[model samples]
Target: MRMSELSRRSGVSVPTIKYYLREGLLPAGRQLSATQAEYDENHLRRLRLIRALIGVRGLSVSTTREVLGALAEDTADTHRLLGLTLGAIQVAGETEPDSPEPAEVDALIEKLGWNVHGSAPARATLAETLASLRTLGSPLDWRVLLPYARLAEQTAVLDLDQLEGIEDPLEVAERALLLTVLLEPALMALRRMAQENESARRHADGTAD
Candidate 1:
């Protein structure tokens, strides 16, 4: 397809596609002529993935470029590919690095027998959240997280199960990113609704503490 056709099919503006080409966010199509380039299905797929990551998931251009770089690496191992994607998605936070919180998180993961890597971004997020809880004087014991961990494990199974029929590595990467960034807000909203329902069931009758 020509640049016009590519832009039309991708639902992205021609100028934007040119910008992506220049920014190295989108790879250049085949050079059919000095003034013309031909794109293909892969280009279209990549364009959609770029739109989803940037428009829907709100990733910065650099982060999206890094994610695309990881996806382009020749790796069929889904887990490793997921690790690469996740590593790129870690936005900076207010918490300082290299704290004792990681050690406590490690012990809790050991107790739960989770297969989470020590260097996973989620591990750092968990550690930071726990540290904040302590700073706020409402620290939760490790035992209190057991049920939540089990629930998260079940959700993880569901997440991986959704990728079963997807064979394309790029599609898998896009799905993984969407599940984490796009669907997460929905999941959190559901959790809030569930909490409200539980509160009503337990405390609405005036016998609650």
Candidate 2:
């Protein structure tokens, strides 16, 4: 197919496809003539993957490049690459210029007395996320995030339970990719539903008062 067909099929514009080709994110097509290039199925698949990584997962171009490179490697390396990508997206607690360390996060975990393993990525993710939230001026302290963290943990467990039954490696990878892409919207809708329910309850309680 020509660039136009590739663009139409992949839902990426011609200029953006050209830009990706220039950046070496997508491989250059075969030069069919002086001014035309022919693309193939590989290009179409790659363009879709790139769109998911950038548009859905919110990964930066550099990160997406690294991820695509990893995916292109031998199958043995793909799992490790996925782990690295997940770690990159995990939030660590906030840090400010000369800001004090998040002793509160540690304290909260300790108070909860949960047996968190040393060097657990979840801890680091929570710390980073809290840090980022603080940077964004979240007034509620670390305690406020505990419920959300518990909900996240439950959701992760459910997701793993569902994934455990899948047999095909490629299917597993595709499912993971799709889930990572779509989870944000799913979570947002759940939160919005909860908010509406809470508002209804509050209004009913006020009437009783």
Candidate 3:
């Protein structure tokens, strides 16, 4: 496809496509002339992935570039590929990088037998959230999280199920990114609705908090 066709198919303007090419977010097309190039399905897929990562997920251009770079490195292991793509996503809570690692967090992970990396962003997020709770005078027991962790484990299965049979690395990454980020609000809404239902069921009135 020509640049114009690529632009038409991608829903991106011609100038913006050129800008992506220059920024290294989108790969260069095959040279057709001194001033023209031809693109293909791979480019289209990658272009869409770039748009999702930047536009929908709100990743900066530099971060998007790093993600694209990670995608370029050939990896036969699907797990590693998924990890690379997932690492691009920054989970909401980020405390100081130099903050002390909480031992309770490690103990909780051990209790759950979760094979999470020490450097995982969610680890820091959990630690920070737990710390904040203590600072706010509602210190929670690490054991209290066990039930939620079990539920999260089940939920994680459902989350990974969304990626099944997605062969394209970019497509897998894009789907995972959208599902993980977009579903957060939906999950919160579900929790609120469930709480109301459960309250009414148990208390015979929704007014009982």
Candidate 4:
């Protein structure tokens, strides 16, 4: 397809596509003539992934470029590829923010036997979130999250099952990123509704707010 066709098909502006090409986010299409280049389905797929990273996930252009680079590398191991992706997406070089819940979070993770690396960004995020909850005066018992962790484990199993049939590396990477970035808010919304329903059931008195 020509530039115009590529733009129309990918729903990206021609100028924006050219910018991506210049920035090395999207590889240049095949040269057909002095002024023409042809794009194929792979280009289209890459464009979609770029849009998802920048538009949906709100990653800066440089970060998106890094992620695409990681995805492009040949890696037969999905776990290692995912680790690379997470590392690329996470903000880097920040001193660890002081958090009071690191020990509790570490203990909970240990009890659950999660296979995450000690330096995983999610470990720091969990600790910071727990600390924030306490600072907000809504501290929760770590034991209360055991069931939630079990639910997450089941969901992870389902996710891995879905990925089992996918043989294409790019497809696997894009699907995993989409699931993590897009489904998080949907999951939180469902939890909120469930909490409302449970609160109503458990506190049935007329005076209950």
- Candidate that would win on TM-score: 3
Q: Write candidate 1's Cα lDDT for 57-137 as tens digits.
A: 788899889888877884577888887765667753345566566777787899988887756777777878988997898
lDDT of each: 0.82, 0.70, 0.83, 0.79
* TM-score preference between candidates 2 and 3, better one: 3
| Candidate 3 residue-wise lDDT, 10-30, digit = tens | 888899889999998888999
**Maximum-lDDT candidate:** 3
Candidate 2 or 1, higher lDDT:
1
Model 3: weakest 10-residue lDDT segment is: 92-101
TM per candidate? 0.88, 0.62, 0.89, 0.85
Off by over 4 Å in 4: 91-100, 137-141, 204-209
lDDT of 2 at 132: 69
- Candidate 2, which segments miss by more than 4 Å at Cα? 89-93, 96-122, 128-150, 157-178, 202-209
Model 2 TM-score on a 0 to 1 scale: 0.62
Scored by lDDT, model 3 comes in at 0.83
The all-Cα superposition gives candidate 4 an RMSD in Å to the true structure of 3.3
